[model samples]
Target: MATGLDANGAELFTLELARFNGQVVLRSVLRDANGLAERSAWFAIDPAQTAIEFAWQAAGTDAANGYLRLAVGSAFQVSGDRREPARLSGLRVLQQQGVAWVSLIGTGN
Candidate 1:
């Protein structure tokens, strides 16, 4: 799980990776006054390239959308069609036993 913060360093959301059906997906939960609001769909992970690709429609809008092409390594890099509402600050990948865990920090815009 990852916690995302706003530009001023306030917690904005938490993100997780999970299995949905037979595919892996990214889940996001916004932290608001009413508590957490969760949103999840589909995303593609390319092990060969150590990258994740996803596109999500902006809330209450059909025209505005956000996309990400995140590369994972000792440090993370955003490339390709990357256009996110948040600014990434830090990322780290860790492995224990056979599971991989990703920690991300970002500034929500």
Candidate 2:
């Protein structure tokens, strides 16, 4: 299981694994200490990289849409492509997000 916090440091959501239709499923909902809001579709979980990637898409639609999002920690590294690996220090976004005290937790190693 994992937890997300908003800009105000409020509990934003919780991501967990559950049994759905006799299969293990991962899901996320916008319900924390505040209250219940909406549920975001859980896409993929990369345990090896300690990352959970998701997308907000319409049902019955299998298209490349929404954000290519990721939440990871120190041991995890973001890349540009399959062949070329990207260095976080080389990216302006990471510099803006700040890597001072990051906590990355997931089911993966």
Candidate 3:
């Protein structure tokens, strides 16, 4: 699991990658339900210097779990994924908390 924080150092959300029924699932826990920009099941979070770009979408979308570019001290909900590029966000190894999976099998990048 990887935790993304805000400029104030508060826990904004967590990005987790897990294998379920032979498929990889990407989930997010926003600080509050209102933190999310839309009522979607998944998000493609691109971490940037000032904000985290989130692309909200339904579950089971293969392109949903690509790659994110977040660095830290990044605020959440600054931008919506509707206009951002579509890239599946990856879990940052260095920013992970809890049990880190050094080697994940079917997580297609």
Candidate maximizing TM-score: 1
Error of 2 at 104 (Å): 2.6
Clashing residue pairs in candidate 3, if any?
47-69, 47-70, 65-88, 66-88, 67-88, 67-89
The TM-scores of all predictions, comma-separated, are 0.40, 0.34, 0.34
RMSD after CA superposition, every candidate: 8.4, 13.2, 13.5
Candidate 2, clashing residue pairs? none
Residue-level lDDT of model 1, residues 1-109, one tens digit each, is: 5555546565445555677676655545554434555454434444345544222222223322434323333323222221234544433344578676753333334
Best by lDDT: 1
Q: Deviation in angstroms for 2 in model 3? A: 0.7
Sort order, TM-score high to low: 1, 3, 2
In Å, residue 10's CA in model 1 sits off its true spot by 4.8
Error of 2 at 31 (Å): 4.6
Clashing pairs in 1: none
lDDT of each: 0.43, 0.36, 0.39
Looking at model 2, residue 62 earns an lDDT score of 39
Runs in model 2 lying further than 4 Å from the true structure: 31-34, 40-51, 54-109
User: Model 2, range 14-87, lDDT digits (tens) per residue?
Assistant: 45555655554455554423465546554333455554453222112333232212443332212111211111
Q: What residue runs in model 3 are displaced by over 4 Å at the alpha carbon?
A: 33-109
